[model samples]
Target: MKFKITHITTYLFDSEVFLEPHYLRFRPSQTSYVNVSELALTILPQPAGHKMVQDEDNNSVDFCWFEGMTSQLTIKAESVLETKPYNPFNFLIYPQNFNTLPFQYNVLQKKLLFSALEVVPISKVLSDYALSILQRSNFNTIPYLTNLTKQLHDDFSVEYRADGAPFIPDETFQLKRGSCRDLSWMLINVLRQQGLAARFVSGYYYFDMVKPAYELHAWVDVYLPGIGWFGLDPSHGILTGNTHFPIASSAHYEHTMPVSGGIRGSASSKLNTELIIEKL
Candidate 1:
C-alpha cells in the first residue's frame, strides 16, 4: 500500500513567549518493509537553527532551536511512502527455551535490553491479569502474547485522549479503558513483569477507510531472542505489519512523544493537531 500523510500541530499561547529547543519525531522510521519517497517539514516562526539527528533508539529526530518571542508556533510534516505486505508472524523464535513463558534472554541480549527489561511496580490485579493470559496460552510465549493482546482489546474500551502521558498500568487496568498510549504502556509493564523486554512504539496506523481523521498511534515492541524486535498492537489485537509505520520507539513512552520541549514564559497555551492519511 502507498500512502501520503500530512500532520499539523499548532500551539497558541495567551502571550508571546520564548520558544525553547524542541525535538520533532515526524520522519517515519524507514525499514525494509517501508520505503519513503518524499518528505517535507515546515515550521512557522522558523527556527534559528535546526538539524536532523538520530535519537538514542536510532529514530530520526529534527532538533530545532528558536529565537525571539512568538504567540503561536506551527509545525507541518508531509510524506509519501510505500509499504510492502508481509506476514507479521513470519519469523521463528530461536532457542527452544525462549518459546515458553517467563522468557529469559541470553547474557549479551539482557545487557543490551537493560532498559526495556526494567520492571515497573505493578499491582496484584495487573499481575494476576497477565498470569491468567499466560495460563490460557499454556505457558507458551507466542500464545501468551497473542492471548494477552486479544483479551486486552476485547475487555477494554478505547478512549480518545488528545494529550498527557499514559496512565500507569494499574490505573489502566482498574479503569478498563484508556487511549492507545495508555494501553501500550500498560502492555509494556505487563510484559516486563513476565521477564520479557518490551518497548513503547509511536507511529501511524493506516485504516482502510475513506476520508477518516487520524492521529499518532502507539503500540508495543517485544524483543524476542532469535526474532529480534517485533511489533504488537494491543489496541487492535493484531500483530503490526506494513501498515504500521513506526516513527519513534523507546524503553519509555515519554521519549517517543512527537514533540518535546519547554517554554521560557508562564503563558498558558492551547494545542491543536490534525492528521490526514490518504491511500494513493
Candidate 2:
C-alpha cells in the first residue's frame, strides 16, 4: 500500500519568544516492512539552520535551529511511502532454551538487550493482574502476550490525549483509562515484569475504516530470540503489520516525541496539531 501523509503542528505563544533548537522525528523510518520514497519538512519563520541526524536507536531526526523571535511557530511535514504486509508469525520460535511460562534470557542476551530490559518496578496489584492473564493463557508466551493485548483493548477506556505527557504505567493501570501511549507503556511494563524485553513505538496508524481517518499511534514491541521484534497494539488489539509507519522507537516515550524543543522566553503557549493520511 502507498500513502500520502501530511502533519502540521502550530504553537501560539502569549508573548514573543526566541525559539531554540528543535528535534523533529517526523520522517518515516526505513525498515524491511516499509520504504520512504519522498519526504518534505517546512518550518515557518524559516529556521536558521537544519540538518538530519540519526539517533542511537537509528531513528532519523531533523535538528533545526531558529534565529528570530516570534509569537507563533508552525511546522509542516509531508511524506509518501510504500509499505509491505508483514506476517506477525513469520519468524521461527526463539532457538534458545524455552521451557517455562516466563522466558529467561541468558547472560549474553541480557547484556545485549539491557536498555529494552530496563523497567521500572511494578506494583503488586499490577503484577497480579498480569499474572492472572498469564495463567489464563496457560503460561504460553505468544498467546499470553496477544491475549494481554486483547484484554487491554476490551477492558480499558481509551481517551484521546493529544497533549501532555503520558501517564506512568501504574497510574494508567490503576485508572484503567489513558491515551494510546499510556496503554502502550502499561503493556511494556507488565511484559517487563514477566521478564520480557519490550520497547515503545511511535508512528502513524492508517485506519481507513475509522471516522478520523488516520492519526499518530503508540504501541509496544517485544523481543523474541529467533523472532526478533514483534509489535503489538493494545489500543487496537492487533499485531502491527502494514499501514504502521514508525517514525521512532525507544525505551522511553519522551524520547520518541515527534517534536520537542524549548523557548528562551517564559510565556504561556497553546499547541495544535493536524494530521491527514490517505491511500494513494
Candidate 3:
C-alpha cells in the first residue's frame, strides 16, 4: 500500500536564545521497502543553520544550531512511497529464542556500530518485570501479541514530548508502561539481559482505538536465528507489523533518537516543541 506521510515539528521558547542546536531525523528514510522524496528541514538559526546525517547506515541526523537569536527549531517532512512490510502473526516464520544471537552481550563490543540501543545503556542489571518480559516461554502468556499483529483500523495514541531519562529496569517494571520509545527500549534491554539479542526501533505507531496518525515512535525486534528479528511493543503489548515504517534502530533510544546534538550558547533554556503528524 502507498502511504503519504507528513511530519512537522515546531519549537518555541521563553526568550531570545543564543544557540538552538538540534538533530533532524525528520527526513523519511529510504529503506528496503520504503522510498523518501521531497524532504527538507528549515531552522531559524542566527548566523547559519545546516543538517547532516549522524549515521548513514541507519539513517539518523546529527543536526545543530551554530548561532541564532530566535528560540525555535522547526522540522517538516513529507514523502510519497509504497511499503511491503513483513507480517509476524499468520506467517509464524520463526520463534524467538534469544539464547544465541549476535551481540547478545556487551552490545557495543562489536564495531561500535551505533543503533537506537547504543544511545542507552542496556548492560545494567535487569529487574524482575523487564526480565519477565523476556522470560515468557509460552507465547500464550502475551496478552495481546497474537491478535493485534493483524488488528488494524483501531485507534491509537501518538504522544509527542521530550524529557530527562527515566529510571531503567526498576521503575519500568512497576508501571509496565512508558512512552513509546521507553517501551521499545525497555523491552530491548530486557531481552538483552536474558541473553536474547534485541535492538531498539524508531518510527511511528497508532496508540489504541486512536488513529495511526503519529509523529515519531520507538519499539524493539529480537533475533530468533531461524525467523530473524521479530518486533514487539511491550508498552502497547502488541507486535509491530507492516504499517510500522521503521526509520532506524539501535541497542538504545539515545542511539536511535530522531535528533541529537550540542549547542554553543543555549545551555539552560526551556525548549518547547509542537509536533503535527498527519496521514494524507
| Winning candidate number (TM-score) | 1
Query: In order, what lDDT does every prediction score?
Result: 0.92, 0.87, 0.52
Q: Pick the candidate with the highest lDDT.
A: 1
Model with the higher lDDT, candidate 1 or 3: 1
- Ordered by lDDT, highest first, the candidates read 1, 2, 3
Q: State the lDDT of candidate 1 residue by residue for 100-214, as single tens digits.
A: 8776787898899999999989999889989988998999999888889999999999989999999989999999999999999999999998899999999999987665978
Winner on TM-score between 2 and 3 is 2
> 184, model 2: CA deviation in Å?
0.6
Write down the worst ten-residue block by lDDT for model 2: 94-103
TM-score, per-candidate, Cα-based: 0.97, 0.95, 0.68
* Residues 204-254, model 2: lDDT tens digits: 988757576456889999888778878999998888888888899988788
Q: After best superposition, candidate 3 residue 125: deviation in angstroms? A: 12
TM-score of 3: 0.68
Give one digit per residue, the lDDT tens place, for model 3 in 1-280. 5666666655565555555456666555565546554455555443265646657545666466565366555555665556666546543433333232222324443334233224334434444433343335333323323332222112223243466553474455445345666555555565454445567777765333364434566667765435555777654556776666677765655666665664444435555444444444
Query: Which residue pairs show backbone clashes in model 1?
Result: none
Model 2 global lDDT (CA atoms, 0 to 1): 0.87
Reference-based lDDT, residue 8, model 1: 96
Error of 3 at 37 (Å): 4.1
Per-prediction RMSD in angstroms?
Answer: 1.1, 1.5, 5.9
CA displacement after TM-score superposition, residue 253 of candidate 3 (Å): 1.7
Off by over 4 Å in 2: 96-100
